[model samples]
Target: MSEGKTGAPHEGPFLLSQLVEWIDREHRNEPGRIIGNLLDALRRSPYYGPLVAAAEKTHRSPTERLRALPLLDRDTFYRHSPPLSNDILTGPMADAYVYASGGTTGQPKFALYSNEEYKIATDVLGFIYSTAGLEAEDVVGNIFLAGNLWTSFNVAGRALENIGCLNMPIGGATSYDMMIKFLQAFNANALVGLPSVIIKLAEEVERSGSNVRIRKILYGGEHLRAPTVEFLRRTLGCELVRSAGYACVDTGPIGYQCTHLGGSLHHVLEGYQFVEIVNPETGAVRNDGEPGEIVSTNLTRLLMPVVRYKTGDLGRWVEMDECACGFSGKTFELLGRCDDLLVIGGINLLPSDVASGLALLPVSQNFQVVARTKNSRDLLVLRLEASRPLSDAQVLEGLEHGSYKLAKAIKDGWLNVEIEWLAPGGLPRSVRTGKIKTVLDERHG
Candidate 1:
């Protein structure tokens, strides 16, 4: 457990005074031994004391220090040739888990992280549990995917157990019927699963007759559509805590979610590290609301110091607004990977933005923005998931309506691509991994 006691940042930009108050209150009850250990770690980190102390020397608040930090992209991490300056991780090179995100590679890339880095990331995940109202007495029903050596299921399950909470790891791999039986038989109260999968479960319960009494649901690896939250709340009788968890074999788990207007994921644990969001080209910090690449400096890493390490993710800071969750931090949403972009009529587009818009429509369950090239021209295609199939005329009319709105929003005629709506479970699903790749670019041009 971290010696420092802290809680979630309230939604939106944090005032300096508010940040200080939260900082003081959070650490008030913490044991001195924990603080000493953390301080010792910081002291050992050549970069940590200097960076944070400089901010303090300038009389800057935590937020101000964060603002001074820069963002990074996938290219930068590779160019830097190292994630961190300090060797925070330990293990033979062949033993670490390498997870990649993006780079010169045309696909979502991956890299490896030392085993110790994975442990540290998992250690901090308990903070997410506390935010979601997980108690020691609550037996958590984990529905996150399993099968691959991927870390979500194992890391999360271990974290919950580390906190001394009993966990029921029955989900994702099992069918909906088997999952429900596990949940009911165990009398589980807390639920953690992929956002979309849980919503599908909610729909099954709504259509069929099954009594489920869940108190809280903590999920990630899937974007939480507004309707999914409503469905989970209404059907399962639970408060849905949707979070964007950041963990890579290379970078380790870092960010979590803040249910606020500012953004979806707040890099709250940054006090333990430095977080940045930079323009991919200029390498300069992006202005608030303009998305850019994300980077970080993990403080606990010794064998590997992730200093200015690019995460290949892009997002923007929340402009002047208090979050509904009342956490004060520089929160931002995960826009998508740098490679998850599609070019339409010579314009750059993100699948995440389109998905966010479609999320406003309850029928559009899951979607993929598939782009192909023919005769040196980019063709945009959309594959959407729905509960039922639409007739040709109905599809045409729906496309007309959606295109008009999308064209106006994206300001490009080609932004509204061809829409192919399929019935539920029609879309390709990643059964082993939690994340479903909705945007696919198959253009060799």
Candidate 2:
């Protein structure tokens, strides 16, 4: 057992704030010590204690012990540790900060963090913001949605405070004209919000002929498409565009993209998080460059131990030494979520694959896939958000040439595909998180 600052044996309710300091001071590169300390803390939890004890009995090594534990999906996690319940907490909830999950996949559930834990998470996020090129002198406009127990705006505000940057919490609900007015008034050079929102703001800025030149954009909530990134760059005169960070309310901060890496690549927060890539179908561990589901274990969260928690996202490990960012640690490339996979005519398809098929189109990234059954046959309707009408023949040609599986399925009469065009922002979005539902399976309806 490790001793606290008072030289007493630290037992019961480990302070993650103190662990942050310990990792920074002595065990920066020691993965064994880090995992051991985290496992020690987890051993004291009511929900995890019995599981950890059993794993320890069978496995002599810490890695094996961790692997022996059960993996938690969202349903399993909530079933054992229901929202706002004290079943999984190692400490009291009086001093904790609570936030709700986006409920994009299911019902919204609450996640708690002690004051110290929140501080550590925000501090690390602030460090990542700095690594992404935010400076103390930059004026940043935060347009992330707030209120309703959401975490984005609150967390973004706190992280900006740690950076000592001039932050304007304009929020996403504010009108585009008002947001632009505030950005111009404050002389803001940087803005943070959802990719969809940012694109709309850029379009509005161009329409109004504003002189505001946003040099940096930090986006989250959804993936930014290549065409949309180019649009933002061309309209806003942006020099830097990157994801705020990869995180969720349940798991907190997981990974961040350094200045050296762009696109979907992210460096795992090795000090604060333990990440594993496992085969999505078989639950077996995957080697580097092999795509699989992402499972995470948060080392700093003792209030509610998240051990081998399945993130529902797919990714593959990248060679860490290949990046010259100086930090030698685990890195991975995100491949969207497992739930985004759609089954059409007994064939598996990903929304990302469909997007790639339509990459040459002038349409925006805001597209929806509606799967329905007509006369006992699977029918797929691709609703694309476009500024102008698109040629059906051209769009079909692109999709057919993009994927062999899709082409074969369509040609062999196994599936039927159709195209629907909608005005930009016509598709429905989740009221809670403001993200579009990519796949809508209406066969049962």
Candidate 3:
């Protein structure tokens, strides 16, 4: 066990004040010491025993030790030859809770968390909600998708409750009329869920001419485009449409958005986890400001030690002081996932770039990027919903200048581009999570 500054074994309740103090505290550890500690703890787990055993031979120097240790990709991290059992757990299984990943990427697997780990995760989540302007007396409507093994709704509920807020667990699967009724009945001052769900609810409110007062919203589960934020702000009468946090079922809380407005960057929770950006193909760590895949080491969870686990998302490590939020910790900006990248004729493009381009145009909040291979060439289709009616010629004219950056790429023959407009409810949606399929790469399929 690690000792605190007073030399006392640092283990206690997960109080918000203490967590905030820890995050704001001025403490630094030697780089080598950090790696040593990580290696020591991970070796205790049966799942990492083989990997760490081979790594012990290269502990002569810190640089050599880190480089010698192989990167734990998802296959090696989550999939075992004989499969993991309770023996892989570092602590007693009875005292820990097991939450599962939704398996959108692959087969669902459980992540074990000790009592202390769960407390710490929820506490950090509460701090994130507080930072996003959730008041003590605010009635928060938790609309994150919830069911068997779903973590979002339960996580947000626990966090909001920890902060002494009245939480209404109106799940995302609820009907629009019922959701509206619950919001009005509880006077939900804060909303939390997927961005697409909230935007859809806002549209429903406008269509039904119902009066609902949602002061601010914290949404995640996907990227919140600037255009969607603007639409939510105007439709729901909310000033803040901030991200809930950069989190997933596999990792409880990656990071949260800073209080800074008009920025998409998330403040890194370095105190909780160690995150590094590395070249996805080479597994070599990247320098600051260089974009790469995010590999995280969970310093908090011991029951299932997730050290140097690849998260598949692409991002860059940025300086904290660059943020206007006055937060003093390293932060990062997520640039879509590694798998979400589209390679066309030796050119790389991200779906987020398409979304950003669409934001510049006077289009609706929702859109999707579809890529298909035809005649040995990549064809890019952009499906957007216009808030108001626009002729095909007018839409083409707007795209040529409204989002000149995207237009230039198309004009330069980087890829063939086509635009299609969808009616109000034309786009397909996942009813379970209330999120639109952002990318449809049919070329691979």
Candidate 4:
């Protein structure tokens, strides 16, 4: 059956819109329908009783019903990351293709994908591109990370196909020669990658004096500062397209924000997945606009049903108000990881704030904000992965300077700090998974 647009909800299970329709189709607004079904599901499903009764007594709204469920951090999810039985087949895991996720060890989240689910993810993605007014003939070069566990290249390529356009998955981590060749050979019209990666590639492309012109640049997987965006826009001679794919190995591609001209992402397909945020400390549900952990409940996938899988990330809704894009749904901006917080003298400091300060100074390409214990107290080590060559002495000196800079940038300066510079290949990649661990809590303090 014909469904809806990219920004609008589609009519199918495992899609958020379909879930909403299912709720409404059951006459959810009849005051008792929601609660009634809650009780029924509780009795029917082995995992439903406690949830249903709790909803009956406590669920104040749909959001609350979702929130009351348990919240899991990265640790808990990893425990059950690889399913051993069919009882957990709630979403696409039943008949889905499994891919490795990001991890340094051989252990990483097993990503699942169903063809039906993937199609919607692609369709919604296409609709988002259409909002940007991309024509069918637009020849776009996807600069996203590709292959095995990193699903961006494949995902974006599929979306472009669904949108009925030309796509070249040039991918990330390629040699400068290969990247230039692919873009030029394809006569690429658009570019995509991390904002920093884009900047690096743009510089290389110009320095190499390659005769190529890209029309649009889409950046994601990390924050893009306004100044950086403006620089790319001026230097690359293309409209900067800021887009993010809400997909992980565990949840697949969820929802994406349309009208990427800088606004909160519309949770386009909530029916395919259930989304919620909660205060990690109290495990209490946070109201809209409050920063909390991002969790997902997969609505599709018969192989595995993910319930309240904690993403260990934090962000907030733009506002309780409606989206200006004319789409009625929740939209949010990713703040950073939930554990990015640091406790000092019982005070908390978010690593993101520190990272932003470091970004201002062009200190490192990536970092590991590690927490360790020495003696009785805790110590914070800033192991920055430097982008350029440096001597051992120079590296030590840079660490000192970085610590001083961090102290100046953040309050409670002079906190325990150890800075190390790892060579380009020193930091291990997620063994088989494509995910990267930005920070490691080694001390458990």
Task: After the best TM-score superposition of candidate 1, give how far the Cα of residue 51 lies from its true spot, in angstroms.
Answer: 17
In order, what is each prediction's RMSD in angstroms?
7.6, 4.8, 4.1, 5.7
- Model 1 lDDT vs. the true structure? 0.59
Q: Which number leads on lDDT? A: 2
Stretches > 4 Å off in candidate 3: 1-14, 24-38, 60-68, 81-88, 320-326, 345-347, 360-364, 384-395, 412-414, 419-434
How would you order the candidates by TM-score, starting with the best? 2, 3, 4, 1
Ranking by lDDT: 2, 3, 1, 4
Among all windows of 10 consecutive residues in model 1, the one with the lowest summed lDDT is 8-17
TM-score of each: 0.69, 0.87, 0.86, 0.72
Task: Give the 10-residue window scoring lowest on summed lDDT in candidate 3.
Answer: 1-10
Give lDDT per model, in order. 0.59, 0.79, 0.72, 0.57
Q: State how far residue 248 of model 2 sits from its true place (Å).
A: 1.0
Error of 2 at 38 (Å): 2.6
lDDT tens digits, residue span 1-445, model 1: 3223333332322333343354335444442333344434544444455654665566444445534443434454444333442333232355455554342224443455556555545556655555445667888888877754555677788667655677998867688877788888878877887766787677666766888678778876655645456656777898655563654544665566644422255644544455667887878877667888876656455443455677767767655455565655556667767767666665566554464455445554566778886566556677777776555445444444544544543355444346678786677765446455767878763
Measured with C-alpha atoms, the lDDT of residue 30 in candidate 2 is 72
Runs of candidate 1 exceeding 4 Å displacement: 1-119, 162-166, 213-215, 234-237, 258-267, 319-329, 345-349, 356-364, 373-378, 392-416, 421-423, 430-434
